[model samples]
Target: MGSDNSTLSSDVITLNHGVQQYFIPSCEKNRKIKIIATPNPSKGLVNINFENWDDIELSLSVFDALGKLILNTKLNTRNTQLNLSDLSSGIYIISIDNHCGGASSFKLILNSN
Candidate 1:
C-alpha cells in the first residue's frame, strides 16, 4: 500500500490512504510567543521579557530544582521583574503561560551571595 500526505497549513497536516488521517503539530501557537530571562546566573533579581505578546493575559511561575513551586503570579506587563533574594542559590525553572494556547519554560540560576 502507498500513502500520500499534504500540509493543510503551517499548523496542520493530512494523510491520504484507504483511510484518512489528520495530524496536528503540537505547540505551533506556543512557539510564536518568545520569552526571555536576563542574567541566567542572577543575584536574586531577574528581568523577564516577552515578544509577540499581543496583550494576552499571561502568568509567571517559578519552581525549585526539586519541583517545588516557589512563586506564581499573574503578569501585568510585557516586561516584569522578579525578586528571588529570599531563595537559596541554585537552579530554578521559570515558566510562562499565555492562558490561551501558548506556554514556555526557561531555566534561571539564583545566586544569593
Candidate 2:
C-alpha cells in the first residue's frame, strides 16, 4: 500500500473481514529482474533465466497447487536449467525469495506430454 521508493512498487490488498495482504517487489526498488522458463508447458526440460545478482544468493522454492513443497534450492547463478520430467502434470508456483526482504512468485505449468 505504501512505497518507500519513488515508484509505486509495493502493493497492499484488503479483503473482506479486514484481511490485509502486502506484496513487495524484488530486492531494491530500482533493480529490475525477471524469471523466465522455456518450453512453458514443458514435458520436463525447464530453463530458468534471470539477471545475476552478484554475491547475493537467491532462494528458490517450487510448490504445487495443493501448497506442497516440490523443490527448494539456492541459486548462485543467473541462468539455470531444471529437469522436472518426473513431476506430474499440474500447476505449480515458483517463488524467489531474496535476502532484501523481497520476494517474487510465478506460476508454472508442467505437462509431461
* Tens-digit lDDT track of model 2 for 43-101: 78778767435446788898989999989999888788888889999888878777887
Pairs that clash in candidate 2: 1-12
Model 1, span 1-113: residue lDDT tens: 86556434323212223221222112444346555566668889887776555676677789999999989999868798899989999999887776565556757778899
> Whole-model Cα lDDT per candidate?
0.67, 0.68
Candidate 2 stretches greater than 4 Å from native:
1-26
The most accurate candidate by TM-score is: 2
Q: What's the residue-level lDDT of 71 in candidate 2?
A: 91
Q: How many residue pairs collide in each prediction?
A: 0, 1
| Least well predicted 10-residue stretch by lDDT in candidate 2 | 13-22
> What TM-score, to 2 decimals, does candidate 2 have?
0.71
TM-score of each: 0.70, 0.71
Task: Point to the candidate with the largest lDDT.
Answer: 2
